[model samples]
Target: MQMASTPTTGDRFRQLIRSLTGISLPPSKVQMIDQRLRRRVVEYGLPDTEAYLEKLLAGELPQDELPRVIDLITTNTTSFFRESEHFDFLTGHILPDRLAKARAEGRKRFKLWSAASSEGAEAFTAAMVLEEARRKGAGFDYAILGTDISARMLERATAAIYADEQLTTVPRDLVTRYFLRADDPSMAGKARIVPELRARTRFRHLNLMDKSYAVDRDVDVIFLRNVLIYFDATDKEQVVDRLAGHIAKGGYLLVGHAESMIVRHPLLRQVKPTIFQKC
Candidate 1:
């Protein structure tokens, strides 16, 4: 004789999620939603996920709960140089060419933004590569800005620490040069990014769903990889168009290889499958 829960609760949750972050959570994601919110349910001593959802949708939960829920729900899969091709392009074409143009114009800094930066890996990776370029006498200064919506991820990024396993993808030479072994015994398995690299990399909280970003209008490169697949068609286009507005004319935008087809905004022209240039 147990009663079933109201279906409107789940529907409302989906609607609110999309409104807050522009991520479309489909019905197939019920299990994922429950799994992610399970700890919150337990924390609130709810009977089950249905009660938790009802409370959340009914505005019965604390005001601060939604942000925590978002931090849990949003996927944050990033790494140092996750896509090596982009970095290769940076060194081989983007950086050098931009440096030449800057030198000709008497400009001095190269600005790169990791639009979906998760835990500082992408920003620090760019810093490492750019530092190496500087060491080789590239004669240009550079800075990297990493932005993500998750406060938890931004905190970790600002810490600039990564566990040993999290660094396997990084080459040994680069690791030796760019990361320092953690001094604390409790942090034995982790290494922190070197000050020289961390100095030029910064992270901030940003939601791509916002009407405008607080980022620079003339960034030389933007890595908007692996994040567009979660949005529906309309959101995808809007996000791409907004991001394109931040690119310096003739600067490049790189998306995940899987998301290459989504960057068809008229302000950008496809140069490579996953690379676009601002026109």
Candidate 2:
């Protein structure tokens, strides 16, 4: 009789994760994976990681469970105005220049994309900057689109509610203008993004590994920050190449400072340490 080989727990989990989310977790991260998925394993009433892996590999797990698993394993660490310099550049140079040219060309709309926007902070920050520009006579209408792979994160983003600590870097004037203090006594230390800001922003679920992007094709700026570190070099190149097709001529791409090593594409030239301009 032929013997059937069984995959190790780490092998099974890694394969399942890559298949579902396209995130490749190395074997060294096995402990990290275990810690992250422990809650899910308990939540599903599975006795142990082995049981959870069995159901996941056998395709017997509920469809919705996959997103929840993704939520658990994915890191959604972000804060308002997390990368302050990018916002400064956007408001100080790019928006002003783009608005001036758009005005001369009679184009009145601007589009910005926060490609890996985590829990809406980056997108809202962009909106606040754009609104400030408008208030200062930029004379262009703008919209912001935020996309992420985590449905749970998207739900939190759609709510537009944030904790007090998250606003540490946000200026007092902009905070007063763009946020409403929560009235509920129990929700103390929390604030919600004002309706005007929310009105100018939208959120959607997106996976960068997909063959094509589902976003608007002519975006003027894309903030694909911080998220590229999770992808390998090949995946990074594929994502940047695909994202390049969606950017309008002369549009810009902003990445996190730590992601500078992998930000390379034939059509994009590095304009700053962490910013690229489409040719």
Candidate 3:
């Protein structure tokens, strides 16, 4: 009988990953991370994960390569107009209601955070809603900030290029209006978002697990979708508490449809389906 290989590099890499990013990985993910990062190790001319881990721990790797390591690990699975119902809610329920209330109170500015904005789709979706409101002559001033831990994903988002597969979720009319043909021959079956839309968004590096986030001011809404799945119970509570602190009084928090913190916390009150109001 053949014996299974020992978990030599696996244990060390797990510690390194968790220490650097606060992302916990299960045993099944060890081989996956190894497969994904082994090429990078070779590219860096490191003999093994132990050597790479040594350099990474010592902060001796090239600055640009560090982001590649993170990019390999961070999940960037997103599409335009994802969670379509939320966009409808923004138009039909949320924005108009927030606008009316804020205007009545003599406040015109609104802030939104796409806390796990992967590849800028959700962020741009919010912008499209705000743009629609603007076209309707609404006197609302807003800023939408898209933040992610993956610098590589953010760069792609900032560029606003999308594969044909990714563009299908985007509305046809909006695509024609907002996206221009790709100029590079290498970029077939792709479209790039026009400069106008890109102007309205700002991307930043943020780790949700980090205690020190710069989003100090209260925000009207936070679209923190599809992110809590990576955390355990304790980390989930910590993340929620930190996120809730940034929500403006009576503002809302939106998580992925699959995520639940209903019995998980006391400060959040469920309003509509998949939407929570911070008390």
Name the best candidate (by TM-score).
1
Tens-digit per-residue lDDT, 1-279, candidate 2: 989789786788787777666688998987888788898789889898878877887779888877888898888999888889999999887787777767777888898999988799999999998998888876789999999999999999999988888888899998889889867896799899999989989999999888998887878899999888888778888888899999877888999999987877888899899988888
Give the CA lDDT, 0 to 100, for residue 221 in model 3. Answer: 88
In candidate 3, stretches whose alpha carbon ends up further than 4 angstroms from where it belongs are 1-8, 45-51, 54-60, 63-65, 182-187
TM-score of each: 0.96, 0.94, 0.88
Residue-level lDDT of model 1, residues 1-279, one tens digit each, is 999877678888999999999889999999999999999999999999889988988899999999999999899988888889899898889998788878888889999999989888888888888888899888888989999989999999999989999999998999999889957897899999988888889999899999999888999999999889989999999999899888988789999989998888888989899999888
- Predictions ranked by lDDT, top down? 1, 2, 3
lDDT of 1: 0.90
lDDT score of residue 248 within candidate 3: 78
- Which 10 consecutive positions of candidate 3 have the poorest summed lDDT? 258-267
Off by over 4 Å in 1: 1-7
Clashing pairs in 2: none
Report how far off residue 121 is in candidate 1 (Å): 1.2
Write model 3 residue lDDT over 28-83, tens digit each, in one string.
Answer: 88677777789888988888776876787678887777768878987778777788
